[model samples]
Target chain A: MKRPFQNLVYLYILAGLSLTIFLVHCGLKALTVTVPAQAQVDERVTFVMHSGAEPRIEEPGTYTTQLLAGIMVPKSWNAREQAVLTYTSPKGNGTLRMIPDSEIEPVSGVSWHQAAKNMFGIGPNLVDDFEWIIYRSTQSYTFSNNEDIDFNVQVACNVGSENMLVRLGFYVGSSIENLRPEDDQYKKFTFSDVFEVSGGEGDVQDFVNPQLGTIQPVRSLDNDIITLVFNGGVMNTVLDGLNEVYLRAQAFDSDGQLIAEVMEQNDKTKMGSIGGRQFRIDIWPRGFFAIEKGKQIARLEYFFTNADGTKTVGYGNTEEPFRYTFRCE
Target chain B: MKIKQLLLFAFVAFGYLFHASCEDEMANVVTDEPVKNITGSWKVVQLTRNGEDLSQRLNLTDFRIDFKEDGSYILANELPFVLVGSGAYTLNDPQYPFSVLMTADGESEQIAVKLQYPVVNGKRQLSLSFSLGCAGNTYQYNFEREN
Candidate 1:
């Protein structure tokens, strides 16, 4: 009779254990799992946790230790104990969801601070609001050589703004490099507000370089003109060591039509200040002839007479002619 | 004792749920191809200015340029004056829209010009524009491939 009773007891215990296991598994699975809540614009969310009970909110990854604030559980909590959390958002009341961090795509049209915090889980420490605005408003281009010697030119401009900055970066094959203004002789490589317009016609800005000669952009009112001033000062410098020079300008319209031609003549009397290096020539798209705003000025062709005047110094006649496109506002 | 065992089971189940929700981040990369060589002869087919056609102004016949592989070029102008000039040319960028630096023979000065190589009517052509620093003039040249 006692052996039968013991067998019955053992059976009862086994049944109880199985029931407990099933209940525990079901209870854990039933633990509230919610979808990620989307906060409305300018909304604030508050999280509340019960005392002495902590919830472990691990980052959504196999090996990420990044713990977000307010949701992370403390080690002091009981091993088997789960914390009770209540979260309230000004936008709406919703259950917090457990989704992988990677699934959180940044929403557009939000403040930079909010975007940074939501996407990176860090504050806006790398770039501030002002800096971010400037970055968004600017356009930049970088040019470099692939050779062993490092030479680079970086230009940045805020479009529609009045200024542009150009920087030259040079590095030898070795490691050390420094950008020193003193080492820059020609100053041609550096320019500030190079594209700024003085607003009216006849306003001129001169670019001086010992190696490159003087170039001036002079604005004229008649045809919305911007004349490239290349006079004896520039010619003498360009043809310093040579004798006899032939100079010609070929002007074209926006339709690629040749409209005007100016050739340097041998008759010094007709040429303004014959033997004087000073010369003024109009670029394309002037006043009434100007292309609509934002359209590039007509292209210009330059031909220089060789020292012998027997031939012209430029891209060969059969080869492509050299061209320039300048635009005025 | 029974409660302890249930807690252990619950913990294990919760751990599994957390691990199943993760995914690996994906990466995407893009690349660009470099430009081709522009070493060849080009003939001037049209010359224009300010919405006007001035092809008759300069003799377009026998007007051609020969660019050698060595960066040396010869311009043959067969008009008013039959002149042939030779010079060194340097291309700043090895790309479609690039600047050309031409130095006349025996002259150190370089005249910089921008050019674009485009295909027109199934023929390779070079389109260029420049100003002679004149008061109100610009020139456009369209050159077709000769060789």
Candidate 2:
């Protein structure tokens, strides 16, 4: 019995030893490890895997390079009639005009390749057929979606006093299915019918809508854009001499909810030009209107305020006030 | 009985030897060497944003970062603006994946960056990778030590 007990002790010790070995092995594996120092830095390390082959770097005189260069040229340089180039190819010959800026027009039968070569000096084989197709498709989509949907109004203001403020307001009338002025129902409208506006300069102040009661503020009526041009130039001394200028516009939708508000102001110092002379103010509305296919009437209001609390105001009914009625088809 | 006692002794001895060997191997793997100090001007050779090459975005062909020994850095470029950021840097791990931390002067935020020092065309290059607070987007900048 003593001998058997000794053997049993040996077995128990073996099992315990095996268990300890296994535990130690696992513990070592779980411990955090740092990479060997010698293999740390590599010269050809790749951090990002691109989806495709690397893009070729742009080269000088390439088609794309020349195209971008042409676009960056001043528009006034291309506007001159002397800038036109005449090109002749095996297929045809035509006058390549760089008018209208950034665009080259080839006369009747001249191939686009010949025009591009003559105008931008880009070789005909530079642009592949696939690229040409994509370019043409994009141009088609832009021209097709953009039709005669723009309504423009230009106003000229002559500020007689140096300490005067000018204000312009636009109002949009009720929506009609057809924008044509010949519609008999249009004549029945009056100034009271105007409730919304397309575009203007400042935050919409409170306005009493004839049909909707006193709306707190008005918003843009549609996506239509309105711009004010002073003296057909961006800067004029007459506008710069003013002590202060306030430009504001507000538009409301059919549901009488304010949609857009634009406000701009310039003090005397800010109005002065680079040469210390006064500059005219130009209002350029940069956004489009969201008007549906329909007819609408718009009203314009102008005001001039003197530094001494005196004012000059003009309404849509005033002689030659800036206003228009148009249709969107 | 004597055999049984000898076997037990052998097992215990082997275990001690194995444990000692593991400890020594780990010590070699993580050396206690001092971190390298990198203080000098560096020029950006390549810049990639979200895996796209944007090295030409800034006209900085002559741009360089001057790192003074006093822990201040000056970013000088041919562009219109010059930026100066002061911070301390560290290259704690000299091996494969290195850790670097830079803190701008007057800013508590620390920018954590990973870098690798690789030799290419017989010239040493410093490549750093970090995120610009974009979701899952990272920028990798490769620079050449100017001085």
Candidate 3:
């Protein structure tokens, strides 16, 4: 049994302890809570047109890059055109050539070793039987299926030497597809890139051009894609409700150095609503970065829903990629 | 003494809560309903465009419409010119001075009107104005209240 005064004193001590614990708890919370700082978003870039033949990056500016064509420059040894190239690295001198089109006959009656000498300026340890076929088409052409962009690059180096490589650079151009007559927003320009390789590697075939923009929906309404039509181009996928979609656009230079053309992400409507409902998401382009000039970008709208949830539905208008005149000032 | 004090506190709290709820309910906004007298059919007297009268006067001897609050509307000119069509109508926004959105035959049209102020002896009136255009010419039609 404690006296009233003692009870009061005990209460005061307990309150003080509680106050100290509360302060410490608040300090811990303050340390753990993180408020995001202000971030700068990149401006959305649309494709633009400019001069100069070589693949050049204009000043800090935005431009649309499309795949124009897939070309195969076959191996030749007649001295008029040389596909085989020789390099003298620190390890030793080696030879290599742009893959030969198997359709074309080997230099008449020349053995594989002799042909290697004429093509690469040195003999190859092994001659791959695979042939190279370069694919080529302008933006006006549409692909119906996923076809292979094939190539065969042969390389060789000093006997028993490890640092030898065959550096084959493939530069391709794919045109932007589907541009409507009404919208003049972007001038289509076909871009290029250099893709390289090295060593005593055998035939490299079916090398897909990576520098083209591909239409892939982050999410489709009803799992059904909305078929968007680019006036002169092809329709890949569609936009739908509650989706975080991604699309890829790529471009390469003359040396086969792949210049990636990606959605800068700053210009996107991060979250869009239609038919009256809010959904959580971020939308971006994804798939093969393939595009061409005069092609319209169309989205195929579709959707998906929970097995027991309400029916997932979608509806809205789509903005197709249009061609406009762009001049670099 | 404790029970009496507890009852007194509970009674006072209940009274305050009831008054607060009543005050909250009264804060809602109410819009004006359509005039009861303006529910009949009216004929088109004239059609004008850009201060000039047009040749095709609306042949409305056969035109008729009946609007009722029981979710019903009838528009029967059942001919090639005007097929009988009826549907429900909803006021999209009642804050506007005088506007109506009508849906019939699965088609919706927005209508803007001018209303006469001060309901005289429980009777109100309004006017229908139509902007007409034909063959590069435009005009306005003013239809007075029939009743």
Candidate 4:
């Protein structure tokens, strides 16, 4: 027993010393991300991810490198084309460009953009509609063995036409090793507090918190097969703990009329059990609804129901259905 | 003697004609035609509904279409298939297929869909795109040759 006690005591001391050494050699000093508290649709906003990072290169020789930056934004923003990144530092400054999708990064044998996504996934966001938009400084910097530099990047991006609360995530790293943190908080990832894009149209999509159900491939056409999911176990609802669930969905035309739509509960509209009391239905919107010529599904309002068409549950366990609007950016 | 000479001449002429006819017969050249053989049972390994993957979320392992060597198909599904029940199928172009035409039962109208025969992971994949209900929605069903 005494030998075990001595071993534990040695372990505690070793852990403390290791942490101290890692902190002393920390490359990232600080990271601060600033996004507009509120902005308008179609408005171009300046989002900032500021970081003070010194080179972690020990036994450094003169080497060339570029700073890697990534931002997780709503897919609706179409940031790949509409956003521009630029940097500022005591070393130098220049325009930053997006690393094209699937461009191989030599170190990881994967695309640099994909490597970042693999490293930091969605960054505490609840929905999968967000994408990691990454960029690299077009200008490479040469630092000598004795030199050190710190910098930050600013992004000018266009907000989408949807009014929603978006939780934006920002990340910073280097091309040296596209992997983990040698030290805790290597300015690796951080998220901005609820950035708002107001004065737009449609429902407010909350990205900061967990949603009961969200559609994948948020932008879709009537000719697409849309899968609707319900997490009855996520929160308390009228339809909770029910083994059998059905979907009652109404498809509206562009004129908002219930054309080519059916709001019914039947075996065809029955939700399949995905375990955990979660339910899903994969249906082609065109085939599911009886639409005439020139008629199409513009949006959908849906609810989860128990057998006999009773105990229906809607958004937030309320009476109103969860709605989704379909469009491409 | 004249009658004998005439008979001999007729016999010689007949013999010469038979020889010439034999020489006129050319050998029938037989060349095998190239066949694009995707004949086998194919399983739906991946089903994408409007660009959304439903492979993991749904149990689509049982879904399949068997293309027999006799140019007939048995659809083992009620899936939003364009053609229903057993059908006689044909490729629009044998060498370079652009579409797959399916004639169900005795239906006069044939159902056709764009087809892409691509080799993925060294396995032949049959990819078909069609709209069963409304023409707007497109579902891409990728089926792989079953072992």
Q: For all the candidates, what are their Cα RMSDs to the real structure?
A: 27.8, 32.4, 31.7, 18.7
* Tens digits of per-residue lDDT for model 3, A214-318: 221211221111112111111222332323322222334334444335433322212222222322222211222233323322322222222222332222122
Q: Model 1: per-residue lDDT, tens digit, A1-329?
A: 47878999999997797655432321101011121122222222222221110112122211111111122111112111332222222222222222233432233234432332223231211111111100010121111221111112111111221221111111111001111233221111111222222233332222222111111232222233333332434333434444344445566767988765556445320212224454333322332232343444465666554434445434323223434444433
Off by over 4 Å in 2: A1-329, B1-34, B56-58, B77-84, B92-97
Shift in Å, residue A186, candidate 3:
54
Ranking by TM-score: 4, 1, 2, 3
Tens-digit lDDT track of model 4 for A1-329: 47878999999997787656544664555668888799999899998888866543434335566777888888778888798888899988888888887688665577766666666677766665777877888877776544556677898999888888878878876655455534354546788888888886666777766677666556666655667888876788878777888888888878898766556778788888888878888776766785554677888888888887878888878888888877765
lDDT of 1 at A155: 16
Predicted complex 2: CAPRI docking category: incorrect
Identify the CAPRI category of the predicted complex in candidate 3: incorrect
Among these predictions, the greatest TM-score belongs to 4
Worst window of 10 by summed lDDT in candidate 1 chain A = A128-137
Question: In model 4, what lDDT does residue B115 have?
Answer: 92
> In candidate 1, which residue ranges exceed 4 Å CA deviation?
A1-329, B1-34, B56-58, B78-84, B133-135
* Model 4 stretches with alpha carbons more than 4 Å out: A1-30, A56-60, A106-111, A176-187, A233-235, A260-267, A272-278, A290-295, B1-39, B48-53, B59-142
Each candidate: fraction of true contacts kept? 0.00, 0.00, 0.00, 0.10
- Put down candidate 2 lDDT per residue, B29-138, tens digits, no spaces: 95666545556888888776434464654334876766677766676644211123455654555443486666666767766677777787887777777653222335
In model 3, state the lDDT of residue B8.
93
